[model samples]
Target: MARNLDIALLRTFATVADQGSMTRASDILHLTQGAISQQIARLEALVGTALLLRHPRGLRLTPAGERFLGRIRPLIITNDEIWSEIERGDVSGPVRLGLPFDLVDSCFAASLKSYCEAFPKVELTLVCAASPDLLDMVGRGHLDLAVIERAVDSEGGEVLAIDRLVWVGARAGQAHKRSPLPISLVGETCVFRPAVSEALAEEKLASRMVFETGGLDATRIIVKMDLAISAWLASTVPADFDIISEDAGLPPLPSFAITLHRANGARGAIFDELARQLRNAMARPRLAA
Candidate 1:
């Protein structure tokens, strides 16, 4: 037999159940109390039983209503989600993300632009930090997603983009100088530190870390002074910096992975979608460095 209940009534019932009162549901649905009562009455008649108990405090679900609520809550919710997805198929809201300062110059700007253009309601708040710190923040729920270098460990992250590491230095910095070198390095927990260290170890050149700090600005500052040399993305090299040529005996830099991670569920799906867009954007030839 065909069901005769109104979908609108079921929607109102679900909203009333969720909001806990007919008056509240009326306000939500912009209906009068009498109309709300009539809708509930119609639903009760169709189902051949009472769905709600009129209570002094508020409307409460009857035993039948309780069972019905449990059974249809997820279905209604899923329907709502699907309808919402159809209505605003475009993405929206505060997309809190973390990323290393270096990658911003590459895809972060243009890719995010495309994301925003495609979904104007999206508002992004970007947190810049070292790879390790970014990963930690993403893992802790402090950030929704992150573009991080390799996972710090097994529990680290998911690889989203990968690129080869490259060495850079001040155009006339120590790496380009003849005398003993002043090596500028990033602080601990940064991906560059290990990359630089391993490169030095392979060359059997025991270089000293004369400067250590976070953020590209700090590295660029010391390098601009020509007081020390640092390694970073070839593209991230400041205008005053140059790549340390292989003839200088610096070992070839290693490749690093850009990864993304999220908490395990709906939030994860959201982040995964963002990560996928980032990966696609980075894949564009223009962003490749």
Candidate 2:
């Protein structure tokens, strides 16, 4: 008799590998922690070797596990795509998507790509703008779905994650310590601009707007060059910069409500599935550089 690999177990294993923690995998898969452990144990038993190593920090893939992942990841993705297409059953239409400019380099980029690959027939028109503008577009039915970062206590829309906003500056930069802090901002329409300004004012910290741009890449370059400090969601901050703290004399910024809004006319299975995929992708841990 020969042991057979289980698709369910493989799915759980891949999720754990992607998430780097059983707890996070459980959350993403909607399974109990014990259940995820059991699935991994069963998978290891099938292969007759350890697939994952438990460490103080988190889970790490064994050499065998890494090779196995490389082989099976494409298969799993293809299988899921097929299953999704079959489940949707002839659902095809255009989905107008609105993304904030800041999110283009975040997890949403990968998610959007995955969604497009899975449903190639669904015409996805994406527009990048500030959160306020995106929200307005979605509310007016200009976009089928919009992902926006709103103030933590703001109402309306399906909240996905509560993300912390932080002050960030170039690595080893002394710009943050300068009197009348030099700052870079998106624009007046940016949701973070007013909050960040108000926080600075409340702390009686004088600041100078040294740069302003709506492009995240340009802003990143300016920050990386130690030109000025700017505010960003902690998770979305580029790896090159250092997050400033109160000890650095920067006032604390409020958390943001990562919300998803759908137009009333766009309520359907396709919309729900897109939202589900987005949430799953966002829930995954940020990719390590």
Candidate 3:
């Protein structure tokens, strides 16, 4: 039984979701209240699940509805642009963008905001993961483009930025001076791991791996509590954390080249627009000592 979801029904459901009331959705869609209710019922029957709960407080999305909405909201955005916004001179379609976890805090976020404002009709999806994972997605055509990390001249993609790695710690923290210095490290697959660990080894520093994660927030929290010292791109280090000076006895870290990768199969004006934005934002002099 192959069937396509009715865009009309989806638009009705999404309208109600955004408005939070059947009456409000009916007003926007210019349909009678009974017609609105009937459309919602038809959609739920087709999906074989109750997508919403109608109560005195109005419509609240069920768990399934929440999941469905995240997937379909992009569809709705594209659809609305084709029907109503295309003539406005804005391109419309879904673009899957991937990047490493640390780059989110850099100037990339500001460029993303500007891109969205310039092309509101584009359905932009952001996927954050490790550099290797992001590169894999780009290779398999699961992402339109990705920003990844690699050695200075190694092939990850086209180099967009060069970021210096630095030892980070809580302000005035004792973790750096403690015997068997506590340190939080990223996953083994990370490009920085080998360089960071080897740097410490060459210095004969006795350190303990206190935690391992690919997440920025968790690493920041662990380091902020003075539980461990961690390494990060100088640009990604939080304001409160101090980059341990060389006099602090930590070995210097190597620099990583940030690069842009495009899906082999991806092509279109919208994709190019975003790629240009990221390149402009990142391909600048941002190295920190």
Best by TM-score: 2
Q: Of the candidates shown, which would achieve the greatest lDDT relative to the real structure?
A: 2
Q: Tell how far residue 162 is off in model 1, in angstroms.
A: 2.9
lDDT of 3 by residue, 48-129 (tens): 9999997776788999998887677667555644543344355678999997888875658877887788788899999988
Candidate 2 local lDDT, residue 206? 94
Name the runs in model 3 displaced over 4 angstroms. 1-90, 186-188, 283-289
Worst window of 10 by summed lDDT in candidate 2:
280-289
Residue by residue across 41-148, what tens digits does model 1's lDDT show?
A: 888888889988878767788899988766665554445446445644545677788878778866567777755665567677789888778877766878887777
The local distance difference test score of each candidate is 0.66, 0.80, 0.78
Q: Estimate the TM-score of every prediction.
A: 0.60, 0.70, 0.66
lDDT per residue (tens digit) for residues 12-108 in model 2: 9987886567886786577999999999998898788998998886799999999987777666655655677777655568888888877766768
Cand. 1 Cα-lDDT = 0.66
Question: Candidate 1: deviation at residue 77, Å?
Answer: 31
Clashing residue pairs, backbone N/CA/C < 3 A, model 2: none
- On a 0 to 1 TM-score scale, where does candidate 1 land against the true structure? 0.60
